[model samples]
Target: MQGSNWPIEPIPNEHDVYFRVHKNYIVNDGPYMFKPRAFVERGDKADQHKSMSTNWEEYSTPEQTQSEAKIPMDNGVVAMSVGGLRSENLTVNHAPIPTIRAHTDVNGLPDDIKDVEVRVKLFKHCRWVINPELSTNP
Candidate 1:
């Protein structure tokens, strides 16, 4: 809670919360809502092996993440706890912004199907922390 704008060396604690900006990551149907691909890397050279960017809740407020960090707020934010992600064998690491990475097994190979499973688990553990439609005009 007392850090600078950028993420620091210490990994967030299990009880700590983080937020994922859901600009184009969400799906809305009739009465259902979910993230289509919440934690996948964007395949950009800069984000090749890292999960999508997330803000450490203790270090940043949702408003700051959206405004100061310049993360889009088209949909909203998904609040995820460190412990919750660990349950799915994922590790939350600190980059410029905190990122979620899957824990590799002995083989150290990336499995596409397993990645999908992890994304689903992450989606289930998340809850909306902001609603742009009601909280922002544009």
Candidate 2:
């Protein structure tokens, strides 16, 4: 018939498309490993006196960048290769030992923690890390 038309598919909603990524992509862990608490961030404390946080922003210098690249901290200041959302080649019961080193009271640091270096083991996949290094004061 002259009025006949071919069927057409509707365009997908861009917003809806993004939501499916989490369901489609699969992460394989066989040879990969890192610290258990590597991805954790310190919880924000609500100051009773101040209305809002008094945090200030600072740019990293060339020297600081070099130092940060070499060391990884449990406090999550500097960016390290260990704490990625996706780590491939990881096997169960085979967690790699991660070394953490930080300068004394630097990188948005509090007054308490100081210079430290440690090698810690992560048992399987866990939210919390169990290690002797965490017990000692830096």
Candidate 3:
């Protein structure tokens, strides 16, 4: 919300990349769209939207497409969509094939927003932080 203490969304993912990493998975580039400022429409009454989504379409519609889609998501996931890509043809340079998965116990999120409950790409940055940890043998 406008008054929440949440810092801010990193930035909306570019819609044309065709492929980009999120939680270590090289997902379809077109579907990696991101939003910075989202607001749920007044009409939206779905429990899912009230809990996670904040976009107008998310709230104004009946039976959101998200419920029926096979898109993988987090407990509070609010962004990105998996529109089906040919895994055999897509390749990610550093990411392991198959899928890159993560389990979050609110590990790297702002504590204030954690209780508020919003889906985000926090896994995106977690991966970035891992390079240093892995690169240094220590």
Best by lDDT: 1
In the range 46-125, model 1's lDDT, one tens digit per residue, is 53354545666655655555554345645465567766676667766555422323211111114452466666676666
Assess the local accuracy of residue 122 in candidate 3 as a C-alpha lDDT between 0 and 100.
29
Task: Order the candidate numbers by lDDT, best to worst.
Answer: 1, 3, 2
Q: For model 3, give the 10-residue run with minimal summed lDDT.
A: 96-105
Among these predictions, the greatest TM-score belongs to 1
Ranking by TM-score: 1, 2, 3
For residue 75, model 1's alpha carbon misses the true position, in angstroms, by 3.9
Clashing pairs in 2: 29-90, 30-89, 30-90, 30-91, 31-89, 31-90, 32-89, 32-90
Q: Candidate 1 or 2, higher lDDT?
A: 1
lDDT of each: 0.51, 0.20, 0.22
Q: After best superposition, candidate 1 residue 19: deviation in angstroms?
A: 3.9
- Model 2 stretches astray by more than 4 angstroms: 1-30, 47-58, 61-138
Residues 66-131, candidate 2: write the lDDT tens digits. Answer: 333324332212222222111322111111112211111102222222212211221222221212
